[model samples]
Target: MSLTAFLHSRHGRGFSCRAEIEAHHAAAFRRFRARVMPRSPFYRGMADLPLKALPRMDKARLMANFSAINTCGIDHDAAMQVAIRAETSRDFRPLIGKVSVGLSTGTSGQRGLFLATPRERRLWAAIMLGCYWPELWRRQRVAFFMRADNALYRSLSNPLVRFAFFDLLSPFEDHLARLADLDPSVLIAPARILAMLAERQAAGGLALSPRRVISVAETLSPEDAALIERAFGTRVHQVYQATEGVLAMTCRLGHLHLNERWLRIDRDVIDAASGAFCPVIHDFTRESLPILNYRLDDVLIPDPDPCPCGCASQRIARIEGREDDVLWWPSVTGPRMVASEAIRTAIACLPQPLRDYRVVQQGRMLHLWLDAAAPGAEPALRTSLAGLARRLGAEPPALVFHRGLPPETDAKRRRIRVLPEARTGV
Candidate 1:
């Protein structure tokens, strides 16, 4: 890690109030406007325009204009080729000059490309290490489980840090012995993977005593988090990151705080009552490929109360899967968003605990998969769901129970999902 980045990351730029955050954003934006914008051919002409005036960017559009959007003069086709080769071969060492290219297989199944320069990678390493490192003086083993490895992540490896990457594409059973031998001090993985490891530990098939456990790359439900914490005997810190940037991370108190020091976020509100909205990003730190006016479909429910940790940035209660994952139910006012939390809460209230469950909405009908001891659990679930619908002021969708949950996959585990077709049909 660079000395400057290490120093800055060790002690974050604390904000005393909302005004202080805005002032920091103003200075960052001023420097970005003067130095960063002119380099990108796409944003060069729009330097004087307000952030909102710039064209809105999503994965599709970002990939379409990748060549013009990046400040490093990296061609889209060339970068895609390099990234594809690395992904297919499982060798992530290839790079175009100093810029490393990687692919993101989003939940939508659409492939997206992300570029990071050497400086950006250094900053990322510094922030991740300086913030999450358990003990700086002691040599620590770090285990990272990810679908694909990138040069950005490799920066964590040094003589003082033994960074190991566990590939998700391979059979999970194969990793047991290697993981057991490594005895990582810091463990990081997707929430579901972490849950699986926790299950293994609980089953007496695995044993680990990691100082730090972090959940990344997936939306971690409260139930899963509780189980993981119980198994590991430590708080599970979460890093809400994307190809755009590290949007939010857990504070010392384990509260999710938006990374407002490097970027500004504009919310496109979906539900006014709950303060749920999609984040529109404006990252001043991403100079290589400026992520200005980039919008993400993931729904974030904001916490109105201040974080006890005293980070003045916004606190996100949870990252509710995607806009498409949010269930829509008919109401007197029209369709209302039935948040996943409500459904989880209703299930929690059931008299007989379900062994496992999955809720998938298929056009006005919900395929409720329940694994339980007795059939009476169905009626209890029905009653609980009906009560939830009433509380939300919405008519419940038809419930059709299945024997058990469908087979689990390494792909992101989302318990609640509303199909694309169900949105309009509902």
Candidate 2:
């Protein structure tokens, strides 16, 4: 069967049944193992282990064995070169055939590429449509915002859905103009940008009202989440997608539901004391670059209770921050890094006015990039920000003021960046 036909048939199937889901996953896993083991030099080396005995893998190991991990036909360096070329171009679609790649914008300090086979992409489309917008299965209009690149754009398009790509590189005014014409029913964008759009909608500058406002790319801080919710007058749904693949998504009740049917999560607990698990996923949905027990950098605290939304799927809190987002306590004489979730927690606690900002650490100093609504709001921001920094341990670092936060060329806003300099004056 064609990937799309087979996948579209699987929607809302008894796959949601735990017993059935487990059986399907086991069968899929075995099939994937059979396909990749003999052909992939990387998988071949580890083929001695029964599927149950292979050690869970991490990113470092993946990178180390990248050449061997992929299916026999793919050339890793060639694929990367194509991805880079696709990322740099302006066409509405990319050149990769039977291969789908989407770039990720996160402060993980690594450029992530989500690779999928034709089959995986088809399945992803089905599930995304089934859970997030069942209406789309019939024909609908979608307005999506992201850094403009043909490859990324191609992935978001479908014959059943009319999609208009909003380039973050374009001025907000331009988006408002085009959106007024597109009149799409759903708006999916980065959390901060969506919040900005919501503000414009409130100001009467933008006229389109989307039935759903989906937030992606960045972690939606609670304060920002409430702001978008209030500004748009719609429940903001969260989508957890990375260059790796679709990680999890928010259900109607605002609980994060993992896409476990396609990907199995073998979680590693970061704070074993608190029972907080970070994900190490085995994605059987795709074979081109099947992700087997691949550890990811995100840190999340799983939700223990069943979601009030009534979906039996596994759910968890939004990723709090990357493992490396921890603030390092400055030491007068020794290795300076120390355990502190202060940066993530402090930023989350900041009042609504400071909607978009970034914190950078250079040795002993903390630098904040502020993008507030009011022009003179810097004074209020200065006070609260410096206070937060001090509470994080550095006495008080230098604060830099800018009219707007700079979006990286790739269109990502880094929330926390670690500087190379050993120290910076407080």
Candidate 3:
């Protein structure tokens, strides 16, 4: 084993030095190459190239070479079957390692299962406790809101840090009652839910002042951040966590800094010409399944300004919305394309009575799913929405009423979806 891995395994500590982190990654890559190259026929074909020179791998390639690539003998089919069972059984926690397994909702047709090693769970607990609640690790109640049941709780729950799993599939009332009784000190949830809570707090319907509110799973937009900050009555922290794992986080100034010790974020950019630039990541911490030079579908625009915090780890400006979420509205002259921010702006201008909404695109037709509690919302909302649609060069979409937007299994809230026909121009 590499010195860093050996040290980490033995001492349960992480390196803060940039050079040391880089060296550890190089060593890990070497071991990974040696182990997988000979056993996995797929990687064996690419063994001639330098370990660092191998092309970035995407989800398709990783899934295709699953059994061959995994350092463990866990086959792709078996792992997938476990994930499927977890999704269908209504049991959030399926055993994986000493931790639990939660399946991704697969909004983008790419689904993968996350494995949390026992040591990884401990590290996550320690880091989170240090960051969120340093005063008491075991005492403060933590209420985590996510679609899939989290595995970290199984390992880390203690008398002090009592964990209450609020399944996203459950009714909102169930969560409200649980929170009212628990009165958790730390509240971790998606930004949109916080936004809803903020609205409730304003109307004097909900009252729970949390010491810390950590928003993760989705990109925390500026408006969402402000709303969460106002509702929580505390500085809202952002965790750039996903199915992959905890990748980055906001420091004291709320700047998104890479977890350089565990992962290497490939910094790249898209010029005015290119539509999207995929990020290339090398996760040093992942040994069971190597994630070197893995291309992510999401796009992140790099920030030029140096963070005032002076942390050596690289930083990025606000994570821009994914390319897939872009909305194409119909204008009088042509089709007008706008991003999530633009759509958010239009929705924000509407009356606050609209509880929830979703915009779905099918070919040139847009579908608006509104969960409104107020009467006469449709008339006012329809007019405003249709005007915006026309401005975007998109025809008025068919309006649909949904009791509630379905929560994605991947922990991501899907505000929009593009049908296959739209991509094919059918």
Which prediction has the highest lDDT against the true structure? 1
Which regions in candidate 1 have their CA more than 4 angstroms from the true location? 1-5
Task: Report the lDDT tens digits of candidate 3 across residue range 1-426.
Answer: 233442432344345556876787777666656665655555667656764587668777777776777655577787788778877786756665554555665446677765666666666666666556635434787888877665665544766777877777778766787787887788888777767667777777778878888887777777667877887688888887756656777776777776675676665444332233446777655655666677676666556566776665666665665555555555465545555555666766766577667766767666666676477666776787777765655666566645555555334555656655554342
The local distance difference test score of model 1 is 0.89
Number of clashes recorded per candidate: 0, 1, 11
Could you tell me the lDDT of residue 240 within candidate 2?
87
- Per-candidate TM-score against the hidden true structure: 0.97, 0.75, 0.72
Candidate 2: worst 10 consecutive residues by lDDT?
331-340
Candidate order, TM-score descending: 1, 2, 3
Tens-digit lDDT track for model 1 on 39-68? 999999998888889899999999999999
Give the CA lDDT, 0 to 100, for residue 254 in model 2: 67
| Root mean square deviation (Cα) for candidate 2 | 5.4
Tens digit of lDDT per residue, candidate 2, span 98-121? 665555445545554455666565
Q: How far does residue 113 in candidate 2 sit from its true spot (Å)?
A: 4.3
What ranking of all candidate models by lDDT puts the best one first? 1, 3, 2
* Residue 230 lDDT in candidate 3: 80
